[model samples]
Target: MFATPAYAQAAGAAAPTGGMSFLIQMVPLIAIFVIFYFLLIRPQQQRMKKHRAMIDAARKGDQVVTGGGLVGKVTKVDDAFVEVEIAANVRVKVVKATLSDITPAGGARPAND
Candidate 1:
């Protein structure tokens, strides 16, 4: 008496098969990846490229800020290292890639003067 009727079993059938279903299921995932690539990955890559160009273009007499927060003038540059003069007769060798930003040719003027 508890068994399902034959007509009820025949009424419930499997869905129609189509090749488009797989592609339809994948659309959301593909969209998410594309969004992430443009919104996050692409911009970060561009910033890194610009930063690398800036680091490569550094030269003598350029004032730069280091990752360690020391602001100094670049006295020497090598393939992988830079000599920065933080103060009179005080110099430190830092990795070229560790330089954070290169200040403009003319530094900020003192407010007092």
Candidate 2:
């Protein structure tokens, strides 16, 4: 019944070429990782680099906007923080990295200026 047992044993033997089958199975997975790195990971890295350069270049008296939507003029720049004057005689300390946008180089416009 079910053919001779010897026939089944012969069919189960390993291939003469060794582990090439296992390597072939991994090719698709490796290709997917490469695609993800180029299409997603690389661009994110470049964007972060540009943002770091911008953050490092920040200086005092730059008109700026914060991530929280507060617009202010930078009064002082510290290694990791900034002093922003949001209103007349009203200054606040915030992290330098929270700055979102730099106003044009001429500084804020006064109501009469």
Candidate 3:
């Protein structure tokens, strides 16, 4: 006759449901953005602001190290450019932004006032 068992249960159970499912789903996405800002964006902005302030404060006669690895004494400073003397009687004009560091006063020849 091929008759089966006495009773059978339902095929399968449904997924669990909750009232705040949408809000819970957004947590990981928001967390990733926060992590990215702290790990990447914040440091970069701070570095740029520091570099801008350093560039703005450049002046003549300060010993400066350039982005190109050249160290020179500043001979002149303009709004957007600087003149560096790398050797006696030899000088080069460079962008102010190219200077990476200005030697602190009293540690080297004072910057022209």
Best by lDDT: 1
Candidate 2 lDDT over residue span 1-113, tens digit each: 78755544446666656588889888999999999999999989997777677777778878888999999988998999989999999999989888887664576533421
Superposed Cα deviation of residue 70, candidate 2 (Å): 1.3
> Which regions of candidate 3 deviate over 4 angstroms?
1-20, 108-113
Tell me the lDDT of model 3 at 15: 55
- Backbone clash count, each prediction separately: 0, 0, 0
For residue 108, give model 3's deviation from the true position in Å.
7.2
Predicted candidate 3 versus true structure: per-residue lDDT over 11-77, tens digit per residue: 6877556857876888999999999999999989998897798788777767889999989888888
Off by over 4 Å in 2: 1-17, 107-113
What is the overall TM-score of model 3 with all chains considered together? 0.72
Instruction: Name the weakest run of 10 consecutive residues (lDDT summed) in model 3.
Output: 104-113
Candidate 1 off by > 4 Å:
1-11, 107-113
User: How does candidate 2 score on lDDT?
Assistant: 0.82
